[model samples]
Target: MRNSTLLLAIASAMLLQAAPAVAQNNVPIRKIKAVKPTTELTLLDRVESDTHKKIYQYNEYGYITSVMEYNKEAEQWVLNTDNSYRQEYVFNAAGQCTARTAFNVDKAGNKTTEKNKAKVEVIGDTTWERYYKEYPDSTTHISEAYAYDKWGNRVEEILYGYDGYNRMEFIRSYKKREYSGPVDIYADNANYTSIERGRLLYDLTAKGQDDYHYTMNTNDLYVDEFRKVVWQTENDKLYAREYGCNRSLEITVGSIEREMWKSSEREFILNADGTRPVRETIRSYDETGEVMGDNISHSYTWDNLGRLLSNIRYKGTSSEISYKDEYTYADDYAKKLSLREAIAELSCGNQIYPEDEFLQFGRIATSSYNYVADGDKGESTYEWNANGQLIGGTWTETCTQSGPDNDNPTTVTDRGEIRVGYNADGHMAWKIDHSITESDFSKIEYIYNKEGVWTSEVEYSGDSWDGPWTKEGEWGNARARKRLATRAATTPKFIDDLTDGSHSIEKHDGVWNTYGNYNVTDGVVTGGGYQQTLISTASVPANPAYNYTDPLMPLEREEDEDAEVASEEMWYYYWNTDKGDWELDWGPTDAQRVYENDGNIVADIYDRNQTIVSTITYRLDDDGRLIEETYSKGGNITYEYLPGTNYLLESVETAADNSRNVCHYYYSKHNYVDPTGIESIKRNDASTPVWYDLQGRRITTPTSKGIYIVNGKKVMVH
Candidate 1:
């Protein structure tokens, strides 16, 4: 494991060094136009509606500096604009802006800024932590302190708050923990202490918790968490990660392993293949401590291109197995893996034994993936401007793999073509994906509001942009096309009222129905559309009255509650009837509905006699978000996002044992927005989606539910 981590650390350093560098004179500044690479042409311009200001700026070299927002207070919409946050920039010799900084701003309009400098530092990138002190009058004083660890990780931050009388109110501290390895784990803790008039107040202490983690893995991971088992190699190599928990595990159960491999400067050592190390096989290194090719044990060899040619494996009893692998690269630098050969040369005693059930009984099996490069396959290249904007590309997939058929031994050919275009503001204007059958052209168009928010998107799969294609459904004539097209760009307006239409009440049978607009504005959506009826609701346990003895109290006295029980029925009937049903049994109501003076749904009511046995109130937030919900009989559960962030902080379970357990959550930027305090969940709280620029293809996902990318091109990891 140590060897694996060391190798990965060295590899990451190399990759970082090879990344594109910003010119020394190019200090990154803010830009109003979406930043773009030099090679691509932008087709759209971003216009700000709030300020009614539009501007575009770039580095001297024409590279985009930033996509900026303007504020009325600033008076001008500049690349490096100001808001509650401060912004700064650096430009290179060609005057190309490289690095920019964003930090909280003070009332003085001053900020603490850092330059990216486009240096792409292979190591030692530092972070700055800013502290703020707010007075009772609502004014804040900004101060910053820097503390970092050996690994260039930030560790702690502190700030103070005061009251209107200039008396200290409290102190806030942010602390972090970072571990060193191929993977890094970070945890944050925040503490607040009360202060009065520049002195300590109350007990003077408050506490909070937070955590973050990152990893550099060689074995590709589908999910970020470590619970999943992606695959186990024949050599017993395994790797896994868990998304929500931000945990990962890697193990090399193999005997012989690759180590100390640094392509640059060619640093490596050769050892005889086995579990134990032997002195005779100990390879030597040169004066620079670099293991030279000459020091390689006879067991390994390399090709002229510096690729590993073959590796020898020992199987004891003077037997050996040799494996070789090779790779070929495309013009664009995409590489293909080809297995050269697997030769097992063995010398064993002449004996026959029945096949093991694990292998022959079909309980377990082996599988291999094969790749054959297509030589005659037409090759294509894509070009994007210097702004990292795509001009075009030779989008094609030619090679195919043949494997076992369980679900179905199938060969998938990438048959569709994609073309992307950008707007003048450097935002994606449209993306066209050609149909596999080559009959229709499928496309998705994005329209961004002045605020840079993507307001609407229209998808079409048709032979052409002309008539005879289904919009959402149904083919349309010219007039229909015009109407649909107009509506396609925007959502329909809400009907003001249904008063003029109809307001009728009818009761033919036992069932009575009333239909009418409930408000003058915003027509009531009813019946088939939204019946606004109850599905089910949670409720308190049957028994209600009891001594409710404190478990912490003396055991002899704890039985007093049972002695006081009026009746067995009284002990069991604790139901809150007003709320229709328990929240879990049915569902929570809209927060807006609760805020608008509607009756709060507490819980379901059950009765053999209905004598007010018991009641339970599931806690709810102002936004109608469920807080700590409890089963009054005994158990209680609470769901909430962590503080200062929208990520699911934890789901806690409280039980009769007087003990509580928690399930924590961590999230990648996708599928989640940074939320402050308790979040308001409108619909799906379990699954939130965000978008990803997967090598330039916009893939929208929470991805947890499951996503198919490129029609079997790959299954997205949750």
Candidate 2:
């Protein structure tokens, strides 16, 4: 929608230009015919009504000055609401709203007295508000200040509270630069406007830090087309930042250079597709801009949609690490099988774009191979109903093809059929069976608020691990778009992948290979979406019997003192109830994550329970930097930002065993504001919906209770 104020500003500019100049510094006033000052536009009093009447007063410049809501009470005019009924506005020389004051009234026809009205003031780009509360015997007041830049982006904020003594209560600061451009979600393209900084403070003890933010303009996100935001503090360090980025749309070579700082610079080269970085080179330099240390490079491979096929990391010129993950579609399974698995059958597709779309309310599978370590191989299967809803799947992995038997003594892990059930509103109510378990599957249940936004997720390991699963974590103050409430739970099916055409307990995980690790990543649905990765320990597991206490958890052996430490991660997903398919968001809310660790990231164990020995909770500042880290164990750490930089963490507050903690933060911004897109759903996909009456008989027009599937969604009929 077009902005009203913007339109008015354009009109005003045009009027001034169209005016005829009578003299060097004056415009013709059309031989002023005004009789008196009264003829000029002052506050125009007007009243509007719908269900209730509201009186509006506007200034000569067309700014709303006051608003009063009223109703006729017993044939007499009175305020519509006893409180919060009237508001007055004040403007600055620039015609910008400078202040706002709110007034209240009482039941006895008493209006707000001039003395007790509450007001807020905006000086330039900063906002200052003083809130006062009335009590029978005393009044309390609190003041807050927020600073903004010329672009109207908030830069800093502070709050002051009074108790026995008046003092500065709290503060937050940010560095921001914003830009405008087009963004296209369909093309999966975004161009970002970023503001960031870091500083070495004057006191060397207390630093004044500012956070930063950025947004993307997706239309051909090449070259730098953003405003530069520079912030400085009066500090003694002589700190200077040299950061810049350059790209080429004109060049035939697909490459870019980004110097985040003198000592921190990186380069990326796109693949033939020119959609994503095919190779990235990072180098650290000394003050003289000479290579100071090891140079690292990352090589990436992708499909036509820019989906990553493989990624390899190189140190200097030596290959340090390399891995390949391939994909196969459901319809292409036959061709893939004919290739004798020479090309790993794509399972749970590894392609980056719309892995869910490959399902097409059907099934997709993936297999992986590791040449470096015992050639570990593994595969996973997924099934989606006609509604594109994930219903069940299986996975199998082993260290050695012959066995985790006598010699290799590795873990042969398998998981049974995993099924999901959803509520009527389409939100996942609960999903049973683990992705890694062979049998006696565990379950995870989800709880959502009235807004259909998931609030809590609990785990139930069944009688195998723990009795019943309990709430693990919740969405902390996260915001979401409004959606319908979840409806009654229903089951969707993956008919194609079913061996017996039945989703039953008889199904077993298909063991493909013995090595390699599998990971599933997705974006979280919330404000400021962030990417989250669920990592499984490449730390291989030990062989276990069918009734194995921990299928993925290897038993600690004597020689295993320095064995690959294990860290397990379990991920529970939700499908878009309305669409009946897995939903995707911008990113995950990493702030609310709970970390329980055994200090073993190199273990073969993927157990969430029992291995955890330490637990910590983290909170991020406005700049998305870790400002606080609280542990279940006694102590915690607090962080302060560096001057000028939006994300650089500095001036740490650590418990005296303090050796001057060091922290650094990087900033990247995403536009949460949605743009124009399809407002209605397209339901033209081919689907043969089957209807069955309550008595289990096929029915077209049911006179009795029945359930039917249209497309992939189920509809209740009676």
Candidate 3:
């Protein structure tokens, strides 16, 4: 996703190139045209109706120097006074942008006030940038300097900020690199060094605080081997530390040779043929550095053709089996078969394929059993079209119980079937799932534009397969393809109005029943009402408020009554270049109380006048996973993750009462494959070597002097 503002600027540049030379003094000036809504099957179209026109001035070097936006009111073009609507730029002799200033303009197109300015200077291998913003009484400035290596890698950076009267250094970061090995095996010259370590220090006293001032230090270490990072460690002063290791080994199991790789927190034993891992194990540890309860492992069975046949999971040192799954595939087909026939055959314990010779080696059924339970099992049957698309399927679960009081075993079953339809473009058009046990059904239908791009999706539910259906929800008009842009739904209310004497409802036996009502006084619900029966009545001291000493809160907190009924919410999106997607650009809204900073919802705001609701503060790891969350109302939750993986090893939640709840999560994988490739330059073979480009395209003869692969080795061509 591209920034809409930057796209507008680029569009202005294009218009300037096509503009006629009719301006005074032959200056290059062009009007910014209204960008039409892109009809290229984009999920969400811009609301172009509110688009305003702007004029851009270009220098002789074809660089944009100034931009002024206008508003058409009363059939006249008036200069927009908004600071963001006008900008000026300065360029150096090399056509490099040196300074950018944004200011407010008067009706006469004269700059009235300087809002903000940024200037940059570059010398040899170093660069400096300064930013200034004007407030009512004082102007604050921030300065940053960077030093880069010859290979264009940043080696050091420093930041300073003005503290009203004096400038103070705030942060310093340094990078360490070593040139012992090639940085890129595919490049013409791979002599550059790689970053091996880094350190960052923060001056806590930069903001003029002495009592709470202590420099914070962060260190990172990266160990590279075989052109890949094999070990990494991070330490945050005396706060926390973590390390990760990745390695591979060759071992023999019985008479078969196998490859093994420790991936993150799990160890995988690959198959002898190097196709996939036949076994995996995950072990966890406690806070005291002792091994926790049991180690989870998964073993897989595959056929000669590399097809999975069965997978079994085990736990603990005793090797207690947990669950087992078996798969069956069709080997040959004589003719095409109907979906009903295929499902029926698989359900009857037959793995026959279609008779029309449509598909071969297609998985037909899978059965899973829980070994912990005497008679708990599930089975799924699938029917696929010639296009290899799943068209129909059935899922069934069966449970059997027998006790001393009962001589015969009783069996219960729940079954469901799903059917899918695809459009001519091979996109899913509709799908329906019918629950045989409950005699209910739900369906989703997709709508596409003339260009065959999916535009809308609607879900409906019905009591039976033949009755009238009720619309549950609809999502459509996504600006980013396949991402939900808007959703509208009319859902049933679970709780009554929050006014005095309001009660909550619970669904029981397909009917909603109202519970006891609650007492409300002064817009705050009292504790000794119906809520007491549902929750504890104990009261704890209010949680500590969020630290506002840093002046980092970008939005003001407001107090309002919590709505118990369904309400609509609107979200604004901004382009995230790192994620290559649109992310919510959040602010204070009636529907949202959380504020985001650096891609994290760091704080929750509550109205001071209303009841003191819990405000949550989050702490994240380097990978942006939540590690700890503290609530101002009395409890905190901490998560222990498997090193270098998103999988959680354990989580502890402490309530306001100081009572703690601990949970452990176990993970297992079957048929995992380790990446295989040569990470170093290899000697070329004697035979005529094959040449290929970086994109893996074979080259008949070298016509250009560049990097190419010869005999599986990358080499520079002269």
Candidate 4:
């Protein structure tokens, strides 16, 4: 879930502030509003710099009239001499906010009005309608329109796209109906506090359509949410949503049997508390509401204090599967005391009868485990330091590896202990995971920058929080993250990874420029490097209307995240301090990127000195999910859909050899197995002379020059 928060620095401030309370009337489907924002805000003043500030002047009705920016120097408040920006809200005599205009201020204190892009009209109390306009090229064009009800709930939303003649045309539409439920239940489910007595979502919106036309719906309260499909089918199929209480979803056309009408039902059992959902059973049904297959069930057991004790799974009618989990805790406060044990006694499966005569009855199964709670079993205790940090812990559990059945299961007692050390800033600086069975210990180390970002993470083995910690697994690097640009992380401005070595830091003084170098390796603050970000000359908008806390700040997409930037100049490095000095010794390459509206990079490439080096373009499905990506030098890689009608990726076409200067990329989401250790990879059993590229590609007799992994060893092949 943290991966989903990779947002732009421009909007980063918005996230730091508490979001506006969602109206008790109804929670909108789209988190952010499509229409322009209102100048009306409870907070009237915003401090941008130590000396620079913005003041908002509002009317009696609480609508901002005009915004003013000022500078305070030497304890004196004066108009900013270097810049002038202002915004004024225009209202009709009827107290209707018609338009908000932006103005540019001259050094002489004269003001000139620019375009009035935002327009909204309150049509009676219950209906507020507005047209969405885009200023892609400094010219405004109608892009969307929507209306909201009196309770501040959006009832209708429609989008438009430019036609061949540059005229806007209708593209998609969405509509939501109002329904009520119990207030307490609604608030808990929606994860909100303080709802009016009425249930905000007493009846939930079962199905909805996105701009791409793909549809998704849920029959049970939360099952569909767990497995929502972005696109309706494998083939490029589109559908519409029929909104109502019955909430049955039907494909507009075609028999992509998967997209046809379907529903999910969930049954729940509760503990004595009556609130904790201890057991849940989910069933799948066809359009006719007929049971399509066997129902899967999950039961959870919890301690008196609400800590989960064990989890169990059941098949078809009350048939217990081998899958179960038993947890142990040191105390109520020390939550993550230790990983007690994971047991898989037998494989779990469901007997399925062939709906088609072509196939016979069979059972589908996957590796599973069962856990039984016995006296003194599944217990773990942890010790805390004087500072209340988890220092050490011990775990004991009875584990059974997958076998034929639970009746004749081979149960094994597994025990392990962990020792952890923390940094001055309270981060787990070092940790040792001991496996009693294998008599082996796995240790992990972490490092952070001044900004408290976990900039480096590494794993190892053999010692108790000490190394020969030389077991290098995944590189810990937060090079792409931005804080105060001067942080050592600047070394990563050009490089796309977190690997440490010799890195050049670039500062953006109004514009990105090469600054200095950082020599930190694997998170240890090593050689000197500058830590500072240059002042952005374009820090504030040119429009005077936004001089008072720019409301459009959240909408400004960081150009870097969207497309291959057409940079005038770019920094490239070719050296690292990973012992081999195989890092970016050669500095600087000019490149640019292109992106979609919401900061999704579509292409990355550069036309350097009249000779184009390479270009990699990402292709996404209609639902904005990545499916294929093509490179100018490397071959194409296409992706397939998840098998069970989910909107997630299965295995995708992986790049061959990244060291070859060919593009090796992953989509926004990664489901690939982590290659932290050799045991994780089931290497090819082929006896053919094995050689792999740096990016882990099995190749023949060292074709092109570069470093190759031959027989599990790194070898140079130049």
Q: For candidate 2, lDDT tens digit of each residue in 309-343?
A: 56566656567554444454343222112111111
TM-score of predicted structure 2? 0.34
Better of 3 and 4 by lDDT: 3
Instruction: Write one digit per residue (lDDT tens) for candidate 4, span 1-718.
Output: 0011111211222122221111111211222222322333222233233344443333222223334456667887677533334444554665445655445556444455453335565566534444444354544545444554555554444444544344434344333334222222222221122222122221222222443433222221111111221212212222211211122434322223245344665555555545345666666776576787888777766655555565677666576563675555444442221111000011111101111110111111111234433222365556656554567777666665545664665667878887877777675677787878767788867645435545445566674445454343221223323444545643434332345777665544322334666565685434433332212111111101111222222121111111253333433443344542223333234344343423333433444332346655555556444555555665554444443322222222333353211111111211122233332222333333655455333355665655555444455554
Clashes of each: 64, 45, 12, 35
lDDT of 2 at 259: 28
Candidate 1: regions farther than 4 A off: 1-414, 423-429, 438-440, 444-718
Kindly give the stretch of ten consecutive residues in candidate 4 with the minimal lDDT sum. 337-346
Candidate 3 Cα deviation (angstroms), residue 555: 21
Please say which candidate is ahead in lDDT: 1 or 4: 4
Which whole-number lDDT from 0 to 100 does residue 554 have in model 3? Answer: 11
Instruction: Return model 3's CA RMSD, one decimal.
Output: 24.6
TM-score on alpha carbons, each prediction: 0.24, 0.34, 0.40, 0.36
Sort the candidates on TM-score, descending order. 3, 4, 2, 1
Q: Pairing residues by index, what is the TM-score of model 3?
A: 0.40
Which stretch of 10 consecutive residues in model 1 shows the poorest summed lDDT?
189-198
